[model samples]
Target: MTDRTYIDIHVLHSVPPSNLNRDDAGSPKQAVYGGVRRARVSSQAWKRATRVAFTDELHLPAEQLGTRTKRISSLLARRIAARTGLDDVAAARLGTALLAQDLNIKAGKKETETAYLLFFGINQLDAIIDLIAERAEELAALADDALTKAVADLPVREQLTSGHPIDVALFGRMVADITSLNVDAATQVAHAISTHPVEIEFDYYTAVDDQKTAEEDAGAAMIGTVEFTSATLYRFATLGVHQLTANLGGDTNAALDATRAFLTAFVRSMPTGHQNTFAHRTLPSLVSFVVRDDQPVNLVSAFEKPVRSRNSGIAEESARRLAKELSRAASSWGVTPLAVASVYEPNSDQNTDTLAAFGVPHSLDEAIASVLQAVRGRLQEPA
Candidate 1:
């Protein structure tokens, strides 16, 4: 059977004035779309928030995640030292040589760091520790040069590539030195853009000096300006069920579980830029999950012309536009989705007939369940 499973998640949420993501100029990011300035949040920012949500909210165990950093050698060294009876310094030297020879990753300016950030799973690191522990006596007797040749043929690539770390599977990993270790990302996240034109606003604020005496100049403070923008944003992301399952070593069950967590986190997570000051955590006004068999449909084109407020507000209008696009795409292409679940906070009565056409509204959790059920059924089919 043909693998026809793609989960398309669409979000319509309005946020207050915030610097969720900033540019080099210390201003909220913006992009010119439809010949107008639209507030933008980079995909990288949202993806990071989602990853954190996986640990904090979803409570996934550490084994399912990957660590991305340049100090991978130091981290592996600590584990190697604990697993084997080697000292910290010896473990560090052995870890570096093995990583370089087997994985082709070289150390940077210092011996403790890699040339760039390396993303590897906990299971992958454990495999390295196991290899070191197996040859503890032989490797411990040799110096740096001898140790390098002793374990030169160990199959580190094979051990690290499998057991796809949940993070590496979704976001992907790049190995320039050893291209075979690179993992293709199973999902695509689009930079969120506002549905309407926006102008950047500045908040001029001053911090008062509490200890300054009134006799010595009354005007004593430091002042600064912060740039920000508030708008109803249309955020979009898609997950390929086939690609994700394959990334997980063809484990359909794990793929389904990952999808549930990924969708929930993507919809619920909010980036924290000046969160202590602004605390701009807003839930999506409307969220829709569409399981399409043909291809992933991005409804961002609906807002390409830029929606305007008439009776309904920007968020409400944004929802209607998205629903209409979903209907238009299905009718024009004659391709019906496998399943769809949409949940909207009905604040405004202003909506197109297509909103109801999207299907009976379900709660957020219920929507995720519905999509996951469809995905599970599809994966069970003969492939």
Candidate 2:
């Protein structure tokens, strides 16, 4: 069997009355699992939230970042103008020419646009500008053939992978028309779901006009109902360490740093859906990490039957159920990870041993540090 490295993370977090993820109709997203409706948060929503955290919280450099947009021409145009001191129109023309040679753009369009949304790293953009700058004289000479030849020699893939953004490497990219530009996501995020059955709740609210007196305006100015739900959610994500390392061009140290930042951000980030209406910001009550050689395991099946909260809260009960399920699953599969670490709130009746039995228990900060050290040690060892 091929020995591949994988990192699995599981979290039990409780969100208060809020709509963390919503559908087109502005209702909380839901799915039927185990023959019952469960509150769900889409993978896309959580991934976007996590990516935002990488910038806002982790403070990663912009150079090691990717942008997702359909306005590729415009973005490149602005960058080219800034770098080359060219007029907007000239820069836009150059941008279109460069993108047309590399990307599979449409024909006869006044405004340059990709056929679909594109994810491009900052490094790639800079490389394109550098290539243009190297041939600035030729470009200014208005020699079409010379400019075409110069653009043709540009190495798109090399530039993209040289200083790849952690988010882009983890989440991946796809250029539909040009399959060569597609990148497979190194990380897989499962849709977060409640551990118990959930029913959508509605809040009817109204706003009164401040300018009009009660005598002038007897009725409310506007009124609406918002759909919401409260649940203790189970979130799971797995990262392919081997794939991540490869995506970063075999820089193991960068891989370890990226992994550490990802773990910290994932635990802290929260989706901001209707945040003004329902301010539901929370940290995971329990966080577990496992590094193993075997295939990644998701303990979500533990909640297939659903956990009912009795004396304790849903978060506590869900934690208990998850711990039990993980123990049984690991034993049955005859799987032992290279390292394991977990952080959990104290519970008198809960079986803390279920987790501590596998690996050391630690606080959130300690857990992150320990996991990173373990990963770094593993990478340091020779194959």
Assess each prediction's global lDDT (C-alpha) against the native. Answer: 0.86, 0.81
lDDT of 1 by residue, 1-383 (tens): 32868889899989998989999989999999998999999999999999999999899999998888898888988888888878987787788777877577776898678888888888889987777688776786797788889888888778888998888898888878778988989889999999999999999898888988878766748888888899899999999888888888888888888898899999999999988778899899899999988888888999999988976679877887888899888989876788889887665445446586468778999999989888887785335
Per-residue C-alpha lDDT of model 2 across residues 1-383, encoded as one tens digit per residue? 11368889999989999999999999999988788889999999999999999999999998877898778788888988888888888787777678767654554343556556778787788887887776554575576666666577666545654567888888988766667776788899999999999999999999988899756957888999999999999999998877777778778888888888889888899999999989999888989998877888888998898878877878877877887777776778877677788987667665667555336568878988877777765563234
Clashes of each: 0, 0
**The 10-residue segment with the lowest total lDDT in model 2:** 103-112
Whole-model lDDT for model 2 versus the true structure? 0.81
Error of 2 at 2 (Å): 12
Best by lDDT: 1
Error of 2 at 24 (Å): 1.8
The Cα error of candidate 1 at residue 121, in Å, is: 1.0
Which runs of model 1 end up more than 4 angstroms from their true locations?
A: 348-352, 381-383
On a 0 to 100 scale, what is the lDDT of residue 80 in model 1? Answer: 86
